[model samples]
Target: MASLNVGNLGEYLREQRRSAQLSLRQLADAAGVSNPYLSQIERGLRKPSAEVLQQVAKALRISAETLYVRAGILDEKERDELETRAVILADPSINERQKQVLLQIYESFRKENDFETLSHADADVDADVDGSGSDARPKQSPPSS
Candidate 1:
């Protein structure tokens, strides 16, 4: 029998948990799952159901839609639809630059939907400190000539 690739739900969960500084045991306890089960899931040896994924996402303080996306329940088309809806739901006053950035991000996400591999470094947000004491925002300045 052919094995099914359920996408990277487990790895996504594991990364999110680690990013949140939570241990496997801690995540398992909070998600009402066993450490071994969680470990297997993280290792891609087991697949979790939607309900379980939802519970785990809730425990990790992430949106269930994120979990669904990781689980391959939301395909590229659906994700694009959601992104379009989200952009529409945002303030109409948003500038063209903001829309361009959002489109770039969405395209990058769609192109790098691999489960086993991490997305490109473009997904990372750089923190820059200005001498003017403003909070760090996304690095949008053009490179010096």
Candidate 2:
């Protein structure tokens, strides 16, 4: 576990809530936490677990990894690489083999830079077991003037 930076995390959460124009109660309700608990978290008087942090991130409609990094749950570099890998894996335009090949190349680059390489299993991706990839989009017709 990374060292907890409760103060920084609290301040960041406060700022994000304010930026989203949500009150403490609103955020708490949305995050499925008690109002006082959320308040304590924001005031740096309590350390929230990752689950709570994830709920708060969802309520804020922001990246959960950002909150994780601020709360010392993940390193900044790890978050960056994780996000990149997630994007690569989620791209429906690429086939499973192509995605795996791209990940191998990406991991190699990271390894060359002395970064810890993450396995494919570390990402939350739906496997394309059918061997078919789709990047389907609804066709949009031009508006008539």
Candidate 3:
């Protein structure tokens, strides 16, 4: 039999619920779903509808859009928009380099209102080393000697 690579929406939901320190029963109660049904969904035996996914996401304190993406239900443009928004929202403390990059991105979007024109090369300016380790920033060279 051919193998199937089903969506991981259920797994993602389960993981998020666990991370939030909620039990299956608690999550089901909060989500207004049946415990057994939630369990089956977590075990990959049942696929949840978009409405259920949104409910679960609300109960888990996660974005419904993210759940939709995990469920493979979001369109390409929506997925990209969600991913970009996630990047901006994931980090609360923006370092100087990150702030600069964000500013540049904002300016570029303001000028053209196009994200496709933004390139990794355009953002590579210097090396950013923080507690999280090194990430390549836009390359900046020393002033001429």
- lDDT top scorer: 2
Q: How close is every model to the real structure, measured as TM-score?
A: 0.51, 0.71, 0.53
- Per-model clash counts, in order, read 0, 0, 8
- Flag clash pairs in model 3: 124-138, 124-139, 125-137, 125-138, 125-139, 126-137, 126-138, 126-139
Clashing pairs in 2: none
lDDT (0 to 1) per candidate: 0.73, 0.86, 0.74
- Superposed by TM-score, candidate 2 places the C-alpha of residue 128 at a distance from the truth, in angstroms, of 51
Worst 10 residues of 1 by lDDT: 120-129
Per-residue lDDT of model 1, residues 1-145, tens digit only: 2323653776677789999999999999999999998887787777788788878988999877777777777776676567575765475787778777777886687667753244333233232224222354555788989
Q: Candidate 3's error at 13, in angstroms?
A: 1.3
Q: Show where candidate 2 strays beyond 4 Å.
A: 1-4, 115-145
lDDT tens per residue, model 3, 1-145? 2222333766787889989999999999999999998987887777788999889988998888877777777866676666675676577798767856885775577557544446433344322333222453555788998
Ranking by lDDT: 2, 3, 1
Clashing pairs in 1: none
**Candidate 2 lDDT by residue in tens digits, 1-145:** 3334598999999999999999999999999999999988887888899999999999999989999998888999999998998999999999999999999999988786663334443331333333322443445789999
